[model samples]
Target chain A: MNKIEVKGLYKAYSDKGRRINGYDECRLPEGSTVLHDINLSIKRRSFTCFVGPSGCGKSTLLRIMAGFEHPTKGWVFIDGMPVNGPSPRHIFVFQEDGLLPWMTTRENVALGVRDIKDSDERRRRIIEYIELVGLKGFEDHYPHELSGGMRRRAEVARALITNPDILFMDEPFGALDFLTRLQMREEMINVHMMFDTTILFITHDIDEAIQLGDQIVILSERPTNLRADIPLAFPHPRDFTKGGLAALRRDIYFQMGIHTAL
Target chain B: MGEDGGERKNGFMKGALSKCRQADRILPALTVVVIIALWEWVVRIFSISPGVLPPPSRVAAALWGLAKSGVLFDYTVASLFRVTWGYFLAVAAAVPIGMFLGLWPLGRAVFNPIIQFLRPISPLAWIPLAILWLGIGDKPAVFLIFLAVFFPMLVCVMGSVAGIKVTYFRIAQNFGLTGYRLYTKVVLPAALPEIVVGLRITLGTAWLVIVAAEMIAVKSGLGYLIVDARNSLRMDRVIGGMVVIGIIGLALDRIIRRLETLPSVRWKRMQR
Candidate 1:
């Protein structure tokens, strides 16, 4: 069953009788337009990735899905209800950790759970998630003491502790080292597997798009209409060093406008 | 110790010891000792009158006399109370006002010009008006202190709030914070350091303004004591009161600086 659905999606910003970023000019001749009459459904517990370059409005779409920004003329339904704003049930992990400097790792992970009924239950879940993120001994440490990679781990751990039906990650591993990025992708996939969550991950990396996405949605330059949604034939626990993964990487690279070294 | 280990350890210790000495040790304090020595020598050489300029020893004697009389404590406590009450009033009023101004464009538009216009007027200038409006005693004294402290504090809170990085806001927004929760939980805490800095500035301002207020508006503070001693021709008591005021001001600023460096706030600073 589709856990998340988008239909006839349109997002435009207007102020002082001027359209935001000249998006009105990008609309085609038909009823369809840029971000053009989008229709797509995300399956339950599927790892979906959106790939596009900078200024492709990928982040804007992600923000809309997260309910930070409202769609101008379309609808996004979460669990069969239209999204008004970010609900507690749908957790989001941003590219930057955004961990409160005032909070400890344990507290940062447990911040959104203030509305949770049971304290003991929340504490146990927070601890479990913290341990899952490999930050067991550092639970009491603040965000300042953390390295960049550890801060991101804390963010992911915090987002997961809420036990959302869908985890929205906007370029979560975009700022990490290449090796750390690979490790983070595997960790995130493992997390999804362990928790059985639906993920809507957005990034510009084709290698990353191929690696973790079960459904890779490619977006055009701006007024980002859905370019392609390719399903990964590569199974879980896919080996990066293996030749099969390299070919998949090549296909996505050529498709996304990068030339081969040869 | 092993051959290389001993040398490395010795070098490390030397570096650590020197840093501590430079940062904290008593060499800097030697400047104070030298100044006092020079002052004493100059006074003795000039044969300065005890009535006109009491030597440090005579002033110290006056401090001892005042301590024994229990009069010094009463004046110090009274002055402390006025400063405390007035400083808190300024903070309580200014912080929310500053936050409103900082957070909302409309609030900034309304209040910014008024505050800027009033802020330039010195706390000392308000003395006569404060006495006339509040009419003597604690009211006038507290009013002057408030006048001195309010602007610095308001600016500090506004500046601190303004100083928050745009990244932090975007990050918080991404995590689903909006409305009041965003201001209280995110913006306030993020801007806390600047608010602290303002509080320190106002603490000193309160101390200063109270001295002026006490002298002209009220009659029982360190400033008044100095005035009374001048009339009585007890130069030693006047010098003693001045010393007490200086010491308290220095101490309060140090305490404030210490509070600002508390571990959590320091950690927050490092993150920024």
Candidate 2:
């Protein structure tokens, strides 16, 4: 089943009446479009990665899907209902650090599950998620006090504690060190298996897309449109150093028109 | 004999260490003493009239006289009371209004011009109007202090709220926080460091205004003591009042600086 559907999505940045051309009408300013004619359907409980070059509006599309932004023209339907605004049923993990500096790890996570009325239940869930992210002892630490990877884990814990139907992660591990990034990818896969939630992950890294995505949607340069779609059906614990993975990486690079040096 | 010898050695070492510690304080004390002695010498050598410029000794004598008569106590209490009430009232009013203006563009557009216009006009400038409107006494003095404090506080709080990273708001929104919950849980805490700074600054402003306000609009305060002593040709008492004001201002700033060390509101720069 399709969890989300987008049709004819167009977004442009413009001010009203700035480009008025006629007595009867005003046209949208030219050269302002970010995403044009975007159509996508994301399947339920599947991980989909949107891969694109920098400034290709992949993040904007994710934001539109998560209701952080509105498309200039089109409809985004979640469960056949048009998304009006950000909902608690969907969570967005930003690329940059978004953890509130003033809040402790426990408070940040608890902020996610604010709808939980019972105090005891909220505390239990907060602790469970904090431990799930391996931040058990650091619950009382603020974001500034934590390491980069720990802060990211705390943010992921904050998102997962709410148990959203779909999680939109826009290069959430992009700021971590190489080793931490690899560890986080594995952590994410473990989390996906445990939660079975729909994930729309955006990234510029082709390897990350292949590693985490069940289906990868490639995006073109701005004004961005869907370029190609690839499906990966490799089983869990698949190694990138293996045979099939190397070919897949080459294919993705070919599609992106990048020739890597041997 | 061994234990006694060790105890004596320990005591001697402790005394030496304490004396070394006290040496740190003695430098500033020595500077103050030298300055006072120089001031006394200059006055004597110049044959300066007592009415024109009182020496340090006469200022001390006058301060002692005021303390003995309970005049200094009365004036200090009066000034402290006015500052406390006026400054707190300004904070109580400014914070919420500032938050509202900071968050809402329309509200800011409506009131920002008026605030900017009033901000530059010193609170001392408002004394005559305050007296005209509120009548003579603590009311006018308090009113002037409040006016002095309100604008800077409002600007600081508003700017603080405006300066919060957009990421924080997005995080709060993503978690389904709305309205008052959004403010109490996210906005207020995030803006607290700046708000504290604003409060500290406005406390200084309030203190400054109280002296000026009391000089014109009230019967009793440090400012009144200065003005009254000057009129009576008692330069020593006037100098004593000025010294009291300086000491009080220094203490107030130090107290606020100490508040910056609190864990919950500790600024990044101020944190050890």
Candidate 3:
């Protein structure tokens, strides 16, 4: 059964004329459509990766599904109930610098299970989640003190500790260096395998999508529409150097207007 | 031989760095000494009247006299007392009001223009009205200092809260944090560093206003000491009062600056 469903999702930012403050200057112009007719459904516990061109609004789609943003025209259903606003049942792992800088890793991860009535249980789970993300010794370190990958891991742990039914990640590893990104991808797969949650990840990297996603969804540029949805039936440790994975990679490159042969 | 060269280079760099650190400590003291020496030299060389400009030695003697009499202690305490009452009261009121205005756009839209209008008007300009409304002594002086601190602090806290990254709020919302939890968990911590900076700047303004306010509204602070000395043709005592004000201002600034180094707000330094 589909754990999450987005039907005829559309988003547009209406410019409210001249804004007095500098904060509103970056917003899209009046009636600028970002996401148009985005329809998607994800099976329970599936790992889905959304890949698109820059500014194609894949993040918008994810945010809408996560209920951080509202769709201008259609409905998003999570387990057949409409999403009115962000809920603890679904958590978002921001692309960069989401963990509050003022908080240490332990304090930040503790925010996830703050509602738990038992103090001992909460403390144990905080420790458990921190260790799960491989941030054991760095629990007392602030976000600014941690390396980029470690901060990302801490954020992931914070999200996972809540035991949400769905996790939305918006390019969570995009800021990490090449080596850290590879290590995080491996850890992410382990996390997916161990957790029962449905994961919807947004990334611009096609190769990353091919490696991490159980199903890959491609999106087109502004006024974004679903271009393709391809299911990967193959097993883990996907090598894009040869076989069906490589063929798919080539196909995605072609779809995105890139010539891998060149 | 190569290792010896590397060790010698490291030693040389370390020595240079220590010398730089020493200079940081010594330079300001050196400048103060040089300026005082120049002032004394000019006064002595020109044979100027002491009333026109007293030498540092005479100023020091006047300070010694005030200390011996205990009036200096009393005046300093009076000024600090007023500043404490006014500044803390402003902080208590402005922070919450600023947070509310920052969180709600409608409140900000209505109040911001009025605040901006009042902020530009000098606190000294309120002396007449403050005297009329609150009457003499600490009340009027404290009121002026409060006026001096409040508007700037409100604007500062508003900016700080408003400047909090939208991502933090989204994270808080995603975790089901709302209302009071949102403020305590996300808003307060995120805005704290900037708020501390605002507090420091506004404390300086409060100190500045207290002196001027005391000159008119009260008669027991450093401002009054300076005015009384001038009336009695005691230029040395006036200079003594000015020096005391400068020292206390520096002390107050140093005290507030310590808040910036706290573990929670220390991320502000790293951001730079």
| Top of the candidates by lDDT | 3
Q: Chain A only: TM-score of every candidate?
A: 0.86, 0.91, 0.95
Q: Check candidate 1 and list the clashing pairs.
A: none
The digit string of per-residue lDDT tens for model 3 on B149-255 reads 99999998899888778788888988878899899888988899989999999999998888888777777999999899989999999999999999999999999
Model 1 regions more than 4 Å off: A8-40, A239-245, B1-23, B48-53, B162-184, B232-235
What overall lDDT, based on C-alpha atoms, would model 3 receive against the true structure? 0.89
Write the residue-wise lDDT of candidate 1 on B1-272 in tens digits.
Answer: 27699799989999999989886757668887888788778889999999888888889999999989998999999999999999999999989888877766567778888889999999888877877788979998888888888887887888677657654565566456678888877788778877887888889888987887778887898988988998999999998999999999999999889878865566566866
Give the clash count for each candidate. Answer: 0, 0, 0
Query: What DockQ does predicted model 2 obtain?
Result: 0.22
* Candidate 2, superposed: residue stretches over 4 Å from native: A16-31, A260-262, B1-34, B44-47, B267-272
Can you give the DockQ of every candidate in the order shown? 0.23, 0.22, 0.56
User: TM-score per candidate, in order?
Assistant: 0.86, 0.90, 0.94
Of 1 and 3, the candidate ranking higher by lDDT: 3
**Model 1 residue A133 distance off true place after TM-score fit, in angstroms:** 1.3
Ranked candidates (TM-score, high to low): 3, 2, 1
Give the i-RMS of model 2 in Å.
Answer: 10.1
TM-score of 1: 0.86
Which ranges in model 3 have alpha carbons more than 4 Å from their true place?
A17-27, A259-262, B1-19
